[model samples]
Target: MRRETDRTMDFLDEYRLRPDPADPRLSVAVTGVNEAGEPVETRVTVERALTLFLNSREIVTMMTIGDHPEYLALGYLLNQNMLRPETPVTGIDYDDDLGVVVVRTEAETDFEEKLRKRTQTSGCAQGTIFGDLMDVIENARLPATPLRTSWLYALTHKINQTPSLYLESGAIHGCVLAREDRPLVYMEDVGRHNAVDKIAGYMQHHAIDPADKIFYTTGRLTSEMVIKTVRMGIPVLVSRSGFTAWGVELARKAGLTLIGRARGKRFVALAGAGRLIFDQDLAYVPDEGARHRRKGARAAEDAE
Candidate 1:
């Protein structure tokens, strides 16, 4: 996440939920030379820094594209263990001019000690840790939800087709919360962690039950991403990107169904293989269409 430090309010006012090349707010025009040495001016993704403060103390700063700052802040603190699971978040106030957000809780809390045990995670651009939450994944009892091949194919197609910063600027990642093949919420940010955090925050704020929703991301399946999804209590995690070895091991250990390299007509389920229903036959089903193949796509049978 590239934090510009000051583009929060101004850029957000012009940012649209649907991806648009014309939205100058999400991107900026820059002049550069192309591979052929020709002059080119194109839009690049915008980055901004947002500081999070829990109660009266400053927590941490996050680099983002400026959309959904409030949700990102809440999700960051919650996942960091700075905020208690049952703690009542009284209010979240964002100050655009200052590029800061303050989260108010019902209880007067302090995590001065926990804040020191930070672990730098491989969450892409943004990285931080406030406590030892590495083992929480093993404690989650995910619901035994079945994911059909039909649902998987449809979900990938729709997600790839949806307008997003990834299509608009290339240097972006997105995360979606969905039920079956239907997408319930779509979010994009400079870093994969930011996108995932935004989704988690939205779920927490809205009180959306994660018992049945599937978590999807355009980012790679890493240990950090897996842990966050599991912490949200989501059973199924899908990614269009490849998987990290540690990510796979952790998912298998936690019993979380992790699917990766998911594209048209093909997907590899590494964890929670029991939930998959092979309703679609490979003999009849067509390969992933070129148009819908997103970034980080791999050969269909390469791993699964």
Candidate 2:
């Protein structure tokens, strides 16, 4: 346990970007009563509205934790099909006082019609997808990257141990962009979709190759999550939560390796099982410590 804890600390130190649970702006202290009517003081996630603009056109307003506004703006546009990968970005402007962000691109864009056709997703804080996003992944082919069980175990251990808003406050979601066992960027938000978009924007801005990366989330594997992962060209998507039927179907269709219910030594792969390599010996793996178990893991334990 001590060796694993040391390795987890080392992995966190190597992260290019990770959540700061100590940030005062991300969460606030609240006084509440427990089930036994005992007074308790705890932190709660803060949500703010961020208005996004594509050049001169106002795109949409989102409720976010407000850490990476520029990334959220760019990613939301890209995932919504308003911004293409090949499109050149001139600049991204953010006015924190006004709670607004504008993304300037070299080529002009008009999405007035696409905005009229929007699909509400099953993500927290209400996720919206514009236009026909399904068409974007019809011909998508993800790289057949192999994922080792050892790497999976290492990643889950490190991620769960790393301090974040979700661990500090109970009502937030998190997403991580990782390569093998190393987590690169860890983002947290009130909504799972926003967390994913932030990671997408980071990749686009940093020019990180997604073909060799994996995406991990602290939310259910829904269709929206599967779609966004496929659109990002990532081959592997993992979660500590369970899966939705449509999410599994989409993963199979896109050939994305979808692994969920990943707590401790246990995990379920409903799609793209061909890429998983069972290289770890189960005897050496330890069950997730009760203190470190997230809400999903706890709920699953209750059901069992």
Candidate 3:
């Protein structure tokens, strides 16, 4: 049962430069006022879905910016835990005429097991994940990376400054994979989780290390989102929106840093404050530390 949305807005397809260099350039009118308060127009790309198949079986489809179809397919499967580093992927084929990606996998996976593992997600973009529909806070590792205020600022500003299809069409969500203070990859989709999956697929295909990277999303931090980060073994998950209670609890158990409301200079650490290394104890007071030290000394004296 293959089902997909029909609301594909192909700004890129509708606006393409002609091969004839001698011809005058073409332009289209876009809605919006510019800095001079005049109606402005900018060239943008189209977004659409490309179906994915594994060994002739329909696995899933992705809604993306149509710029990187192969990468998106590969990334999506990896994030969904459908494929691991050792999984033997024989080949991948993309049919532009039909807009479908056929992936050849050698792993003899049970069809029913694969189907049962899928869960329809609430991500702004269409997302499917493995295991239980909702997360249970167990088996998530504790976070060991220290979060810095400066890193958060850079991450938020970098996300805002990244090139986006949404800025032109206002209809997409973006996901970025960052390492330390720098963003390594950015992907946008009609669905937020799909964007992250695309990135994950790319990482898996390229065998990129994700141990120290931070995953950022334009959508809310749901429990499934936390699980995705956990699957990648990444310790940090930052979002521009709020986190669900399940997400917070999972992060606490997983030892992952859950940063939410990542806008401007005001961001909330929803869980795992141990990862946050403050230069000046913003949450801890030196007086409290001294008081504790004094109490310990008094206890020792009383014992003596």
Error of 1 at 191 (Å): 0.6
**Candidate lDDT (C-alpha), each:** 0.79, 0.86, 0.65
Q: How many Å off is the CA of 228 in candidate 3? A: 1.2
Q: What would the per-residue lDDT of candidate 3 be over residues 56-91, giving only the tens digit for each residue? A: 789876665565667777766666666665787888
Q: Of the candidates shown, which would achieve the greatest lDDT relative to the real structure? A: 2
Error of 3 at 164 (Å): 2.6
For model 1, which pairs clash?
3-48, 3-49, 4-48
Q: Which stretches of candidate 3 lie over 4 Å from their true place?
A: 1-45, 133-137, 280-304
List, residue by residue over 203-288, the lDDT tens digit for candidate 1: 78767778887999988999888888888889899998889998998888877899998876667999999889978676755577
| Model 1, total clashes | 3
TM-score pick, better of 1 and 3: 1
Residue-wise lDDT of candidate 2 within 1-304, one digit each (tens)?
0112324434446364565888898889999999999999999989999999888888888999898899888888888888887788999999999999999987966577789989988978678878886875687889999999999999998888888778788688889988899887888888899999998897787666788889999889999999999988899999988899999988998899999989898999999898899999999888898877866568868899
Worst 10 residues of 2 by lDDT: 1-10
